[model samples]
Target chain A: MSAVAYYLESAGIATTGISLVRENTKALRPPRFLWVTFPLGRPLGLPGDAAFQRRVVLAALALLDAPSGPVLEDYPEDVPDLPGDDVFACPVRFPPRASGRGRWGSALLEEIALLRPWYALSRERRGRTTVGVAGTLVETLAERLGALLDAPERLPGTLAELTELKRTLADLRAFHEEAVTAQPGDPPWREVRRLLWRESVLGDAMLTLRDRFDASGDPRLRAFTRVLVPRGALED
Target chain B: MVRLSDLPDYEREHLLDKNLGPLGPPAWVPPGTPLRERRVALVTTAGLHRRSDSAFDLTDASYRVLPGDLGAADLVMSHSSVNFDRSGFAEDVNLVFPIDRFRELAEDDVIGGLASNHFSFMGAGLLPEAYEASARDLARILHRDGVDTAFLTPV
Candidate 1:
């Protein structure tokens, strides 16, 4: 990222950047860098947290004017673990009765099946979701995902397939999130993340698949899937 | 939140230890220039692209050119880091990519004006050579856009 910043500076496009990973920014020593102690994947702050996010942006941009040899300013604000006030929950009740052969796999399939109803409910209530931004119909995409889950042995070989898989995983979480946050009395982001990645069928399925990939002796699949697997799912 | 300095030695080792070799002496162009009078643009490694555009390739270091007029609803993060939850990003993209804030700044004349197009690149797992090439390419485009100042955000 400092390379990019330095390139921008060399181009005479004065640059300043916000960094979630302070070490990387510090080592690169860009013309201007703001080290936000915010968690990875969220350099600005949290979702729906416009004011804080705006403040972070303003702070980072403020560095552009500082007399700089190489600047990595420390942002003073704290980013909460769960930054939003609105809560989320499993819209549907328990007793997911997916009829698959495997235990956790069947439960995960059940959760996947549950997504459509929850997604539609949220769409009806809020008139939108963060999922379809991928521009594919969620229902059809779900159908396509079945094959991938069934054959976790063969991971995506090309960048396109890998990207599709990543977006699909993001879509899955987004659909679940839109569904959960649709109702106002649910849990915060961390709790919801815990629910999905620590306690739910989806997390179990991912861990199971991660182990399978690791055992498959497919180094690329193992390494990449290791990265994509949710943190809580892996940790706990 | 844990201040990086307080993390366990093993846990913080990767964060504190580094040997990024020095480069050519940095050429600093002093800024006597007032920000409000310059043409400004946004550049982010936030993996942001238009709803209609193809997402960034996590492995490849290529980037997308998005129109500056895009709003919160029309942007999405195709970034592949699972370290951060997308829920916040899913709810409001400003958490990772704050183009909306840039618009507000332009309107208030805190900065000059937004360039006609903005830029985004996925910042993970890219080869160093590829990343440098794309960054240089983006620099050329920024120059063509008449952008004098860039507000960059990294996710």
Candidate 2:
């Protein structure tokens, strides 16, 4: 981001930006940047808090007034964690998984069916969903991902297939997160992420797919599979 | 709130290793006008695009145009790196793309005006310099649109 700002400023457009990583901004200093201690994704600090967001924006924009080569400022306020117990467990409990590889696919499909109502309620309530990035239906994506776990070779190695798989995994993640949040209590994303990665059937299938894809011996497939699950999840 | 030190070790290492040296020399251009008189536009690295537009590739350096009037519901994120927290974005697009806040700022005269067109790029899995040409191209568009200031954000 600092690099891009440098390019833009060089092209005669003044730029001011929020730096999530202070070290990067300090190294590749741009024309002007405001460093915030917010998490990786939330550059504006808190979500849905207009006043806090406006303050963050105004603070960053205020950097535009500086007459200098490279100016880096830090946002003063730190976003507080959500006010609630951070522990989260899925509201809907499932029977123990059937033990064989072939049965995992059926288990995944069944899980999808179980979560369908909650996902629908979530979409109706929010009037929007982040589930279509892969451009595939939820059912089809679940089935395809599940199948890859049992028969890794069944996966096609084409670019389109690779892209679809990456996005399908993403969509599935979003679908489960949305569905889980719609049930009873609203959980903090950290706990929800932990639940998705450690306790869910879909999470198991995804990790299985990641392992099989990494061992597929195709460089292109391996390259894309690395990001299928975050590094933090693996550490957990 | 989390700082770089609070991140997982691998992610912290990756971010630190992502430096592209320095882009030749630092470039500086003082704002050509007062904050209230400069036309401001948003440029994001969140890999956001309209529902009708194509999603970003794993290593794409290209950009997508987002009209100023675009709504929060019409945007979706496809950033290659899934390490960041997206719950904020799911709740409010302004957490990452702040278009609504920009609109309010414009209305309140904090900034002169909002550009008719803004830009987005998927900034992961590639070198930082890969964005140089595209950034230059976007600068031309911002220039042509009479934009004197750009507010950038990342995910």
lDDT of 2 by residue, A1-236 (tens): 88788899999999998999888888887889998998788999887789999999999988887877689998889988675544554666754453454766678778888888888887777667777787878888877777776674586568878777778777888788888777433247676677677777887776776777788787887777666877777554
Best of the candidates, DockQ: 2
TM-scores of the candidates in the order shown: 0.85, 0.94
* Decoy 2 TM-score against native: 0.94
Q: State the local distance difference test value for candidate 2.
A: 0.81
Candidate 1 ranges beyond 4 A from true positions:
A80-89, A94-109, A117-128, A133-135, A151-161, A184-187, A231-236, B5-19, B22-24
| Tens digits of lDDT, candidate 1, A86-107 | 4334566544433243344445
Which 10 consecutive positions of candidate 2 chain A have the poorest summed lDDT?
Answer: A94-103
How many clashes in each candidate? 3, 0
Which pairs of residues clash in candidate 2, taking residues 3 or more apart in a chain or in different chains?
none
Candidate 2 lDDT by residue in tens digits, B1-155: 55767876777798788755677788989655888998988999999998789888877899999999987778888888878877667767888999989999889998899999999999888777899999999999999999988899988
